[model samples]
Target: MDYRDVDIVNHQRGWDGYFKLDVYELRHKQFNGRQSPVIRREVLERGHAVAVLPYDPVRDEVVLIEQFRPATLSVHKNTPDMPAWLIEIVAGIVEPGETLPDVARRETMEESGCSIIGDLELITPRYYASPGCTSETVQIFYGRVDSKNAGGLHGLAEEGEDIRVFTKSSDDCFAMLRDGIFCNAPIIMAMQWLMLHRDRLRREAASTAI
Candidate 1:
């Protein structure tokens, strides 16, 4: 296994409320049976968090939220006709004293008004959603949901969240994928998994308890 060690050098909190820091690190690895010593220069900080990809096999659809995100709009270089809204799976930072599964369930309720049941299956955790500047890593999960009673967009307005829920068919979702409709990585991965495992998941849901 390859590994890298990072040591914090100096740090200061930024005006944007983000912590910025300098870091010294050693890249330790063996390449092609040859020992390699590489001197690295960089600064990094603690990462952010993971998002959820909710799948409701019984409805033969997936739950997605449409919300406005100013950060994404700021990065647009084109004519800027693009809406500030982005479609994503339910997500939130893991609160202090809260476990991962709890965060997943809480976010599901807060963002979409849906309740998820059973154990969460871990999908993937990636470090530095964008390692260049932010110290944010995200873990992805797939939670089982009841599709029959799944309703429309219901979000916490107090949190500035206005999410529109969509229950989309696999074929339509794939079309959206081809047209670059989804920017969130977890959602894309979840859709890919659905494309592959929808049948099995449906069968399991039919036999499983509510």
Candidate 2:
């Protein structure tokens, strides 16, 4: 498909802190096979992340978490009832020496207090949370879990995290999706994937039950 387009002329760090900002000056090949004007763009360099959707096949339920997001509050200030807390699947940024599955398991424990039962099923090629302005790719997975004791408040105190966990049936999760309870990309994608693969997952789990 000859997808080659962007040509980076220069890239410089603009800010470095909890997150990084990179300024880029570049040109791209136009549809007419000519180079377009060089433009300056600033990109947020949030590191890669991993998210795990913990599902209990026997109970047809999933575990999720709620946490405060200052960005959401900043953007939706006029709505007094729009709390900063967001409902999402377990997720964490990739550390320097961590694998995707490692982040998934660690995040699952920190955010939901649920232990993943077996190997995680990779969703597929990772996705960018916002490609136009950020270089953050997220690896998604579906992990088997026992959601019997999955509800609670869990998070790392050192990280200033106060997370609340919830377990909901697959049907209820879908209803929340329809009701606009989940606004994050990872959660939406995971739920949609589950919607399509839930039955297959259940059948496979049943076949493997001993």
What are the clash counts of all predictions, listed in order? 2, 0
Clashing pairs in 2: none
- Whole-model lDDT values for every prediction: 0.72, 0.90
User: Where is the poorest 10-residue window by lDDT in model 2?
Assistant: 74-83
Residues 1-210, model 2: lDDT tens digits: 154688899999999998899999999988898998999999999989998999999889998889999887666867766658899998899999998888989988888888898899987568888999999998899989999988989999999999999899999999998988888889898999999999999998899899
Off by over 4 Å in 1: 1-8, 16-47, 79-83
The most accurate candidate by lDDT is 2
Query: Residue 72 in model 2: shift from native, Å?
Result: 0.5
lDDT of 1 by residue, 84-162 (tens): 7888888787668888888889998887777887888777765467777656678888887766666676777787777
